[model samples]
Target: MLQYFTLPVTAFQQNCSLVWCDETLLAAVIDPGGDLPAILAQAERRQLKLEQIWLTHAHIDHAGGAGELARTRALPIVGPHPGDQFWIDGLPQQSAMFGFPPAEAFTPTRWLDDGDTVQIGNETLSVRHCPGHTPGHVVFHAPQIERAFVGDVLFAGSIGRTDFPQGNHQQLIDSITQRLWPMGDGTVFIPGHGPESSFGRERKSNPYVGGT
Candidate 1:
């Protein structure tokens, strides 16, 4: 069984998720954004062996603690596509501008593309390059579980802000309507900084991408 725990961290309150395969206890930390101590504490408490670090995007709040955790655990860092390389490179500036603690930039062990699959124990998650909020943004989908880590792309009642540099409002909408909507409405998604919600619910009521 694949299980996960969400830890809200950082001044931005980003959602950092610890996901593991219950059978083997092999784990990966998704979006460590900060609050490394808390995430490490919980993973230790649960006795999960941290293996890899997965990212959804390269935003400061989404990847702030990635370098620290990767170095601490000697784990591979993966995903967020190659498109966000600029954002990753600008981590220090972003941190300074946002008054965040210093953040380090590191290259991913693997830069993911659409249709790639990553594994945690026996569980396989499909990757989709869903941009707009960030050009290199991606979503992780576990088909067997009908769940996705959507990052800053689509929110419960709203959508990710396209006002940021390189943010494309139309692309964000297309990613939601074309790429995500096909996942079936029952699919539950974890956004970057808020409560969990179902695609079905969002498609029906979300003011940004819901309804015809």
Candidate 2:
């Protein structure tokens, strides 16, 4: 079984998840948004060396602590470009604007392009570029594991806010319809915030998707 650990961080209270294969000690961090200490502690407890830090999007809350964690583990950070490199360069400002603490930012090692695959443990996570929240948002899908780390895309009963620097309402809708919905109805989604929900559940309940 793949062990999962969650650490809620920063004023945004973003959820940083550490997913590891118990047998192989291979690990991946999803949205190392903040709380570098907590995330490192969880990794050390399991004796797992973080191989890669994956960003679902370029939002400050999701990518803020990425630099610290990657520096600590000497791991690589990978994610989509989001076309908001300026926002990435201005993370500290966004944090202060939102009453969040100062943040350190860094560019990704590789952009999360659609059809990209990241290998972990004995399987692979198919990268689906599901933008809307940001121009380069992505969802990591591990088919055999029946799991996906959906950045800030689709939440439990809601969806990502499109008022940010790179956010868009119509694009987000298109992302859900064209990029995410095809992941199969039973796929389990571990969102960047809030609780876990299945693709099936969100399809049936998420107002934005279920409504219009």
Candidate 3:
């Protein structure tokens, strides 16, 4: 079975996820936002080697620690299709714009495609390009654990904001309907911030998104 830990980091408190499997001992770090210490602490506690750092989008709060963490762990850093490459590449500028400490530029080792799979333990994480929160936001769906580490694209009772650069309101709505809601109602969505909720709950209650 897959085991998981949540590390809520950065000023905005993005929930970075550390998911691993007992048998294979393989692990993947999702959105290592900030506070490298906590992410490392969980890595040490679980003794699961981080194979890769996967990003759902390019927002600084959800990607701040990615460069440092990957360098520290010697893990490959992968992002969502590079549509947010500008944001990812301009992290320092983004930090400055958001009134934070200057950070170094981060270039991911790999740019994940829509149908790509990043194996973790025995299962495969299905990548679905669900932009709108940012132009490259995506969600990693792991059926074995019935969990999805969605970035700003999803939340408990609300959806992600579409006011930033490359953010599109209509596109975000379409992504939710076409890419996410179709994942079935049972999928447990672990968003960038706040408590976890299922696709069913969000479909039923999210004000910004309407259910079919």
Best by TM-score: 1
lDDT of 2 by residue, 1-212 (tens): 66677778777778888888778998998887777878878889989978988888768888887777777778888886557577678888877777666777787788768899987686578998887788878888878778888888888998998997768899999888787778878988888888989888888888789743
TM-scores, all candidates, are 0.98, 0.92, 0.95
Counted clashes in each candidate structure: 0, 2, 0
**Worst-scoring 10-residue span by lDDT in model 2:** 80-89
Which residue pairs clash in candidate 3?
A: none
Off by over 4 Å in 3: none
Q: Rate the local accuracy (lDDT) of all candidates.
A: 0.92, 0.81, 0.84
Query: Could you arrange the candidates by lDDT from highest to lowest?
Result: 1, 3, 2
User: Could you give candidate 3's per-residue lDDT for residues 1-212 as a string of tens digits?
Assistant: 87788878888888999988788888888988788888888898888878888999878888877888777778888887789988888899888888756665777898987888887778677999988988888889887778888888888888889998889989888888888887889989899999999988888888888564
* CA deviation > 4 Å runs, candidate 1: none
lDDT of 2: 0.81
